[model samples]
Target: MSKDYYKVLGVEKTATADEIKRAFLKLAHQYHPDKNGGKDDKFKEINEAYQVLGNAEKRKQFDQFGANFNGAGGFGGGQGYGGFGGFQNGGMNINMDDLGDLGEMFGGLGDIFGFGSARGGQGRRREPQRGSDIEAAMTIDFLEAVFGAEKEVTLKKKITCAHCGGTGAEPGAKIEECPTCKGHGRVRRVQQTILGSIQTEASCPSCGGEGKIASKKCSECNGAGTAYDTAKFKVRIPAGVDDGGRIRIPGYGEAGDRGAGVGDLYLNIRVRPSDKFARDEYDILTKKEISFTQAALGDKIEIETVHGKVELKIPEGTQSGTVFKLKNKGVPHTSGRNIGDHLIEVVVKTPKNLNKRQKESLKELGI
Candidate 1:
C-alpha cells in the first residue's frame, strides 16, 4: 500500500530536517506504548514516515518518486538493499548507523525499551545528582511565631559515612574497573520497538555508573557510601512566619551519593491558633466585649495584643461592632522594616434577664 510519509508525521514536504525530527519525536512520545492511550499501529506509522523523510537523500528521492520510493527495487540497486531495510513483521526496518545525529533524540528513551542508563539528547554523561530535599512540619505557638524562637529538630537522615570517608571503599582499598559495562560506566543497547530497532544507552547498574568497584567494602556502612543516623539540629523560627510558611536550610538534607552536593531541608511552619487573637498578614486581630454602660460612657479598657496588654479607649455612644486600631502593637514584619497594627473589634454586651428593680429604674429614668 502507498503511504504519505509527510502526512504520517504531520509535516509538510518543505519542512526542514530539524522540523521533521521534532514532529516525529512529538508523535512518537505521544503514541508510545508505555504512555496512556498509545496506539501501536500509529506509532509504527510515525516511525515509518520519519525513517524516510528524516533523511536528506531519502527525502529527496521520496519527493522525486512521489509515494513509491523504494531505493532497492523501484529506484534500482538490486538485492544490495541500499541504506534502508525492508519491512518485517509489520514493522519498518532501518539501519541504526544511517540515522545520523539521533543519539540526542533517542537518549533517555531507554526506559521504554528497558535499555540501560540513557544519556540526554545532548549526549552528555549524567553527573552525580544531588540528594533530594527533605520536608518537615513544625508547630509553633502564636506567641512564638510572633516573637520568633530557635528550636531543635530531631530527624533521621543520610549523611556522609565517616568510616568510608564519603567513599564506598574501606580504608586503603584498591579500585578496579567494572566488568559489567566494561569500565565505560554506561551500557549501550539496541531495542526492538514499535518504531523499529532503537539504540539507547544507560548507566551501569553494577557499579552505579562509577565504572569502578572497591576491593574492600566499608564494614560500617556496608557497600553503600552513606550512613543513616539520627541528628538534632537547631532551626531558627523567624518572626511573622504565618501558617503554611516555609523556611529553607541549604545542605542540611540527606547527603548525596559519593561526594556530590547535599540536598536542602525545608521546614513548613504551622502557627497555632491563638485564643484571644487572629492574624492578618502581620496584623493582630482581637475582639473585646464592652458593657452597655461602658459603650454609653467613654472609658479606657485593657486589650491583649501580640506584644502585651494595651489600653484602648472607647468613645462615648460607641456603636456595637466598632473597630479600633492600636499602632505598633501587632506582630513584627518579616522584613523587620515595620510592625503591624493591632485591630480591636468592640462588641456591646446587652444586659438580659434584668431584675424588676433595675427594669423599673430604667423605665423611670426614660420617663
Candidate 2:
C-alpha cells in the first residue's frame, strides 16, 4: 500500500477505538480547511485513513488485507471479476444517472451494495422530503438590535392549499390506485448506456410517485397540494446579535410538497449605522466632548449607555481621547448571562476665540 493509516494518525495498530477517535479528532481540528493555516491535502489524507480504520468491521478486514482490500473474497478468482462482470448478477443493474453521485469512490470497478436511487426528477421515492429552507435579509436599527425588539416581516412563499387541505384532492373527489405502476409508486425502465443496457426502477410519471390518483384535482393548487400565498408575522430580534448574524425560525419556510414536512426560515441581520454610537462586537462605543477645564480640573459627567444614562467621573489631568470603561453597561449578550462594557472616548475641546482680558488673565498672574 502507498499509505499507512495508523502512521498517518500517529497511532499504533493496537490502539483502542476511543484512541483512534481521539487521534482523528485532534488531527482533523489541526488540518480542517475551514481553519486558518489549514492544509487541505493533509486533511483529506487523515479523513481517508480514518474512514477505513475507524470502523470495526472494516478495520478487521483492513488488518487482514491491508489498505488494498476490495471485497471480492480478497483474490480475483470468481471474486473481483473483470470490469463490469459484477453486473452479470440480476440484482446488480446500475443506474447511469446516479453513477455521478457515487463520485470517485465507486466510479470504475465498484458496485453500490443494495437498492440505490440518487436524487432525480423520476428517481425512486424513499421517504417524504422536507420543504426547501428559505433565507431573507432583515434590516434593523442599531439600538433595536442592541436591545431585542419585535418586528413584522412580510413573506411571500408556498403554503398548503386551503381548498384541498394539502391532500391534492378536492373535497368529495374519488381517489383510486394508480394504474401506471399498479399503485407501487414505481416502474422499471431499461436504458441503453455506453456500458450496456441498465435496468432501474423509477417513480411512476402518471401519479408523480403518489401511488394514488384523484378523479378531480384541486382548483386552487392544481393538485400539487401547495399554493403561493403571502404571510405576515412578528419576529423577535435577539439582543447582542451582530450584523450578518442569522436567526432561524422553525416551521416558517415554504410548505412541503404534498404536506410532507415544513422547512425553517432564516433571517439574516443587517444593522443600520448609528450617528451617535458605534459598535465593536458586544461593546458599545460612544464619544463625549468635554471642555479643556473638565479634562484638567476633573469633573463628574453623565454618559449615555445602551441600558440608560449613568454618571462617570473624569480624573484630574485626564488627556483627550482617553477611553473609560463602564462595567456591565454595554449590550446584553445573546445568552443573557454576560453583559459587555460601555467604552466612552473623551474628546477635549479647546476654546477657539479669547477676549484680550481673558488672554491677559494668564499674563496678570505672571505680572
Q: Estimate each model's TM-score.
A: 0.71, 0.65
Each candidate: what lDDT? 0.75, 0.73
Q: Which candidate is the best by lDDT?
A: 1
Looking at model 2, which ten-residue stretch has the lowest summed lDDT?
83-92
The number of the candidate with the highest TM-score is: 1
Candidate 2 to native Cα RMSD, angstroms: 8.9
What's the distance in Å from true for residue 240, model 1?
A: 3.9
lDDT (tens digit, per residue) of candidate 2 on 1-367: 3567788899999999878866865676667666677787787667656665666765776678765655322333454333222222212244433433442333321122123332333543333456778999999999998998998989998888899988778889999998777899877766552223557765665576778978887888777778889989898888988899899989989887667688889999999998878899889899999988899889999998878899999999999999999999888899999988999999999866979987798678662
